[model samples]
Target chain A: MRHNLVLRVVAKLLIPFILLFALYVQFHGDFGPGGGFQAGVIIAAAIIFYGLIYGLDAARKAMPDRVVETMVACGVLIYAGVGLAGLFLGGNYLDYFVLDHDPAHGQHRGIFWVEVGVAVTVSGVMLKIFYMFASRGRDPE
Target chain B: MALTVIVLTRSRNLFTVVVLAGVYSFLMATALVALDAVDVAMTEASVGAGISTVLLLGALYLCKSEETKPVRKPWLPLAVSAAAGALLVFGTLGLPAFSDPAAPIHTHVVPRYLNDVLRETGVPNVVTAVLASYRGYDTLGETTVVFTAGIGVIALLRRRRKQPGAANKQDAAK
Candidate 1:
């Protein structure tokens, strides 16, 4: 794969845009056909493409296992924290109505954070799984 | 699409089967787009067709690439599957027409979400609004489910530490 110049160049050219598009889907989910889950998978796909083009070492460096592991736990924390915040703010569990001074604004804020949580966990889990699978059943480098 | 499925069923090489399964998923995504379920389509494209292929391929690397033929004829399993599929086709007859506005589901709490989402959530995408705000608990549960799945995979597949040259110290699976 490293010797394949065409695939290497094409993947290098396409990876950034794939990431940018994932971000667009993540942040603009409120007005678009994509959201956290789709964006997360796309993000993982870009990294996996990079891994294929260069090597597993390069991709692991780009996204370390520690970060991926942290992301997996942190996303759930962020989501649950939002619910806890709602409870603290005198709203029901997982309530977005009281997240901000204006209920509408609060809804937007809550949704934004929740979607972010979803994205993080999804991408993290994906990368972690990919890494786990790729590292096994082969010679150690 | 049916052709892809047929080929998928007939394929003996596991790699070919995995790739054909991805094609089937892509076709399903296209069908979802035609049905105006763009969000689900995007999910199907990315998760179903994209990552699923890679993951399955990775799993395939762990074992033989060729599927061994069954020793005996599986007539009972085939009959059961055919009967189940027929029941599913028959069940579809009870379902409402595509995008039927007056369907019971549409007439239920959907109206509140459709009518009040923008005003309350300030989100234009109904799916996002519903998933994130209207049904926040469900999304939280789903996120936790993803978390649990990740943990489960790590628990099952993670290897212990070995000598220096055997693994990356930072990203060490072994």
Candidate 2:
């Protein structure tokens, strides 16, 4: 438990950087080696690190199960909402070019929104999984 | 072959076995990256190296740390594994070279994604466009799988409620 103090501090320091990097990857995906999926996992990994050092109960208390569940639903809703937006604009599903007057900027806007949805869903799912395993059974050690 | 043989033959510690498994996962991740499947490599690294090792360690705390001696010959399992490995190699021989321009994968719907996604979808990154738009249904299914797993975990781990009468009896006894 004493040794875990260093791990806790390290996790605290590293997680913010990891989350920031994930956002960077999400936004800069057009030019680089990452995109929504990778960015999502990176953010999830950072949260998982926090859960590991702080204990599952504590982590769950910090983030809360209901909030994570809501995030998951919101992500899917956001993605579908964007597609519906395109549909409303008289284009097929997810046809972002029809989203605005300028097609190129519309695509950027669509990608940003979609990536946000993906990132939110992925992070929520990751934390949810960690909470599940950590809370399992009666062994608290 | 030699590494597997050593792993099979040695009566080593459980930590060693777990570490060896991690090494094997790392090797698999390297192979995925070499094949230019960066997405697969990332999942392999995160699931295999990060979550799996931690879970295994947690389980180890509840179980014995020593390996039990084998009661029978391991030759059959070895033969089976070798045959499976050979079949896998044979299967890979027919696969298209990584990033081959003329491969069927490149010539099919994938080409549409690579060539016209920018002009059509207006998304600069073709992969994101493909995942989020072209095959959004599949992505939706994958997200559902994650959601289902989360639900399963929560259901399995939730604290059980005490019966009203049982709680009252316990309180009376106290």
For each candidate, what is chain B's TM-score? 0.89, 0.76
| Global lDDT of model 2 | 0.74
**Tens digits of lDDT, candidate 1, A21-101:** 999999999998888888888999999989878989999999999999999999899998988999999999889889999
- The lDDT per prediction is 0.91, 0.74
Going through the candidates in the order shown, the clash numbers are: 0, 0
Question: Alpha carbon lDDT of residue A73, candidate 2?
Answer: 75
Put down candidate 1 lDDT per residue, B80-132, tens digits, no spaces: 99999999999999999978999999999999998988898899999999998
TM-score of model 1 vs. true structure:
0.94
- Kindly give the stretch of ten consecutive residues in candidate 2 chain B with the minimal lDDT sum: B1-10
- Alpha-carbon shift of residue B121 in model 2 (angstroms): 3.2
TM-score for each model: 0.94, 0.79
Pairs in steric clash, model 2: none
| Cα-based lDDT at residue B139, candidate 2 | 74
